[model samples]
Target chain A: MTAHTSSSSSLGLISSATAISQGAEAKVYYASLHPAPSPASTTETVDVLIKHRFHKGYRHPSLDNSLTKSRVAGEARALIRCLRCGVHVPGIRMVDAAEGVLALEWIDGKSVRFLLGGGAEGEEEEAADSEDSDVAEAAAQEDDTDPLSEYGATQDELMAMVGAEIAKMHRGDVVHGDLTTSNMMLRHPRSEKGLQLVLIDFGLAYTSTLVEDKAVDLYVLERAFASTHPASEPLFASVLRAYQAGMGREWTAISKRLDDVRLRGRKRSMVG
Target chain B: METYHYPSFPADASHVHIALFKNVSNAAELRSRIVRASLLEGSEGDLEREAVNFAFIDARLICSRVHLQTAIYQAVLAHAQGALRTKTVHSEILWTLNPSNNISEAIRRYGVSDTTAFLIVVRISTANDANVLANMQAVVSGELSRFSLEGITDWASVKKYYKLNSEPALKIQGITLVQERKIIDEIVTSTVAMKSVMT
Candidate 1:
């Protein structure tokens, strides 16, 4: 058998071990390097994030192949650009465009939407009631709540991160075509660095400097916040405020465009 | 010479053999020679192919013995099971470097790149446990000269093949040549280790 045979068969080994996380374009799985003896043997295992671009039955083979390759390459390029801009995105570990897979650093945390009374853990609400808000707050203050509680970020903080990250991305001329709380995650707070909001799912991302595109991007997030999380008006306002800080003079143009976008919806009147 | 054993492999599937060449010139010569030797008369062909059965990686791409060993082990598994995704055994070495299934592209980009000088051939076949270590030692201690990096390496060809000119990794400001080399090594190493994560 040729190398190709072995590789295809080995797919069973790779995909099986990864913990699958679903999204629109692909399924993500956690990758790990295990049992290797290291100087720091305790740190033998390194967590990785794998994005598998599954075969799309609807699309034609030729179109699908190019689309898949482009998306994979696009995401990797966007990530590299983000890293250079000092944006706290996951580091790229592997890129197999032909197979439509990308491996990234596995961030240990939960989605920000989950922490902000969103649709992450429905059972947690019932449990939260049992613990009581005051007790939870006390525990939170003492840093003695559930180990994952740190991943449960507030709506306001998450919004700030959203605003800041978008501003940074726009400054670098990269448009995150899709922005939603569910696509954003909060890393576990272990250092003084505090909460880190990570942007995920860049399938639709592209390079563009259009103010209109940037405004629409923010609008997508705004709609997501309102629809998914409860009582998010003030939270979004805080987000915009941080965004205004980061955007500098460009804020006026985008803010105006964003207001227009909110009224007219995402599709701008193309009829000239 | 260093030898490693993977305990998971079946017992009968183990056997060992080694061949040491004196002053093997360059990658091209070595490759053609291996091919020519493999096409020889029946028993001779078997013997020659067995001797050159392992991958002959450019030692410059290697970081340390541990790193090299990890790659070799993975390659052996792929070879024994006929699991290679690429077209050829030579190209499979490049695929082993990349964290993906794009075997041809990996070969086009990495295998036999210009800067390659010191080549290390690795062949895996059924080997008796007792003789494997001794054979490995003989191969390593053979008549080959310890290659010096200064006089070798085709930089222009390497740059052309990998398209390293426009890579952002190479464009980072304030990085020294040494730093660039270290970064390149790391990129290659990480790429090799990430194959499992790739498709």
Candidate 2:
């Protein structure tokens, strides 16, 4: 009744899951948390997003194992920190470090990038995780309505949600190292915690209290906006306003630091 | 009782049979027998272990079916890797559910207690292995019940065990109690999944 090899169980979950997208560091898959409940019973299993930092042939086996294990653990830590801090991040569903698999609550929503018209030219159209979006997307296109409207948020409010969510994470002292539009999503309007902005991807996130770290986080996101969206100033201003409102008294110093960051670029002037 | 089949696991350990028993009457005797089974020796030990091999869980502590399944999946994953924290995958499931590294604490808190009226018996083995439902019924005197987590979760115990009382996630203004429970379930489920990696 035993004597099974290591790592295959999680790989089994992955094999059952449909591969959605692949990145240089990890591959993402969509799957149910349990085997679909028997057809006789109408109970639906929860869906989970599986992120696997697959094995690399170039690195030694032990080193690869340790690296994969640590990275997966680090990402899980960041996500848990966000969840505890009341940030709108997907809850972690599972973590199997030995297999480099991290499972997250599957978000049924559209990425902010697509809602903002920035997804068309992007490399990773991670905007829509919804498999049933084809019909809704087609209808939205037919009406020529802004996709953001369907989520019940105006562009201004979406930006505000984005800013506030980031502020909450910063308030918790967790910095998202990457803050692209694609990394943030608007939960489907009808789901639990409807139409909220949820942040995803903590692969590079870290804990920090330094105002400089927070400012740099804003700066990186600002740059992402400039490069990805046309006429980005107003959009970024909306984000910062909500961010400033959320940050309250802590906003002033970070704002000044952000301005300084903008002048010198993301990299600070280094001295040996 | 419904069986979940995992296509990826080895044939011997591919399926998990779960039976929820309500109004369990012999939990006290069942608990003592389980203890005795652990201490018995030789062929007698083998027979006793086989008789009560299922992981007997207190249904009140489980927030959602996802919470239970996550533990089972992690246990299977550990068993497959030969890195089980306990002697068997069944115990590993209990350990994962307990939220602490102490094995005894896990079993004592999550295992079937004398007062456990709602019991969940789980067995992971080949799908062809018969008598799973019969065995579960034989070990515990209770009525077979539909599998649903509604109305049974003891929220106070769950929140206290997870230490979610003052956490900011629940402290958010305007959040309903239902919303808070959803958050708790999510946090607890994630904790179970990440037990091995938690610092």
| CAPRI quality level assigned to candidate 1 from its DockQ score | incorrect
For model 2 the TM-score comes to 0.93
Tens-digit lDDT string for candidate 1 (A72-189): 8788777666654545566565555656767676777777676675535343455567667547555555864443345565556667787887777787778888788777777777
lDDT of 2 by residue, A242-262 (tens): 999999999999999999998
Per-residue lDDT over B1-199 for candidate 1, one digit per residue giving the tens place of the 0 to 100 score: 2233333333332221222233434556555655577579899787876554555555544543334444553454454455566544444666775444666566544444333445555444444445543543443332443322333334444434434566555665797776565444334444454454333
Distance (Å) between predicted and true CA of B135, model 2?
A: 0.5
The parts of candidate 1 lying over 4 Å away from their true place are A1-7, A18-25, A31-43, A57-70, A94-100, A121-159, A190-195, A244-252, B1-137, B141-199
The model with the greatest TM-score is 2
* Model 1 CA lDDT for position B118: 58
In the predicted model 2, the residue pairs found to clash are: A6-B81, A111-A127
Candidate 2 per-residue lDDT, tens place, B53-126, comes to: 99999999999888898899889888877789999999999999987799999999999998999999999998
**Whole-model lDDT values for every prediction:** 0.60, 0.87
Candidate 2 C-alpha error for residue A16, in Å = 3.5
Model 1 chain A weakest 10-residue run by lDDT: A33-42
